[model samples]
Target: MAARKRKQSPQHEDQREKVRFYPAWCKRCGNCAAFCPQHVIEMDQWGYPHAVRTHDCISCHMCEKLCPDFAVTVGEETPSSVSRRGAAGPSPGTEGSLVSQDHSPERLAKTPHPDEEEHD
Candidate 1:
């Protein structure tokens, strides 16, 4: 007998997932937060990052490529994309650094990367 194909869920859809943030590596920098045109990112009480409006994310990869700590990641939420970009890559603020850390959250509740659960 032939087996039937499994049905896919809405969560499995390619465009449903939003960019991911790596809290451990994040230096609390506001690069990704500032670069995001969608304003999807938001700052926590302690000055950490959080994805307040994930659905608004446009997958522009601006936050990913601009993150100084490689803390912000983008693209489909599939295992393949994670593995491809998760590998050991040069840390942010290096030659390919997309954003600078000049702004401070103390002055304002600057945007932050989601997934960074830390308070500050």
Candidate 2:
């Protein structure tokens, strides 16, 4: 007897805005992939979770809420909230690092440092 093959669903863009995974923060617990309602996440060969079908995402936040290591995040990036890759606010793996607002041009401005000695 042969195993029956499941039919693949048509892919369409959904409500999810962005999906990022911090491999450094992933402990390979597999909760994120296992809990995805849409089955959009998959485990890599090394056991890290990755988005297989981002368009299928429903923005349900099940993966984010279930991640014990905080390795997964699901949020929409508006025009005002857009940031360059690796330059957004705090991410899962970054600890003790200063995070500015999104990568807006204004966010690049040099602000006065509280610890810096003021010049007369």
Candidate 3:
């Protein structure tokens, strides 16, 4: 007897991807494919890793964190965020989370330098 195959809708099968791999920076180390908890990634014959079952990705960031070349990224980049990828500033909704307000200009200006302290 043949096993029954589950029917999946086109929309369901085409789930939005939560992980991305940069081909240029990838060294084909296979760490991302090995470390993926859901087996969402697979290695090609040429030792390159690619997402096989992207629908199963849980956005756990395991692949991204394990990649030695930093070739993997596990989030959708909004237009605004893409332009500010490396900008130094507080992310959205984290404005008041800092206990010491370290990023605030006023706090930084008032903070004393350790080297400038009195010797006595």
Candidate 4:
């Protein structure tokens, strides 16, 4: 008998906004899928969660927080009114998120440090 391949949802997109799954670290606890309000994620035969309706995701990060093993990560969701793609990384849930900050050498160097000044 030939080895059977897992059939997955065909509507997958290559966009940055997605529910990332780390199988190696996953314990298949099903917490993520059950807590999802949008019902974007679904468990397969082996109890592994997969983002089936990624477009419907609100980037709530509910799944990410519910996971006990940190097996899931919800990618940043971009709205039509705003575009975080221009920034360094994905849009964070908060304005002060570190992902939106520019950590480049030039930006870091420009930042002032009180301790760097001579106390004498």
Please tell me which predicted candidate would have the highest TM-score against the true structure: 3
Each prediction's RMSD to truth: 15.1, 10.8, 14.5, 13.4
Candidate 3 runs further than 4 Å off: 1-16, 78-120
TM-score per prediction, in order, is: 0.51, 0.53, 0.54, 0.51
lDDT of each: 0.57, 0.60, 0.60, 0.58
Candidate 4 segments exceeding 4 Å error: 1-12, 76-120
Q: Using TM-score, rank the candidates from best to worst.
A: 3, 2, 1, 4
lDDT of 1 at 118: 65
Displacement of the residue 73 alpha carbon in candidate 1, Å = 0.9
lDDT of candidate model 4 versus the reference: 0.58
Q: Model 1 — TM-score against the truth?
A: 0.51
What TM-score does candidate 4 get on C-alpha atoms? 0.51
The residue pairs found clashing in candidate 4 are none
For candidate 2, what is the TM-score? 0.53
Candidate 2 clash total? 0
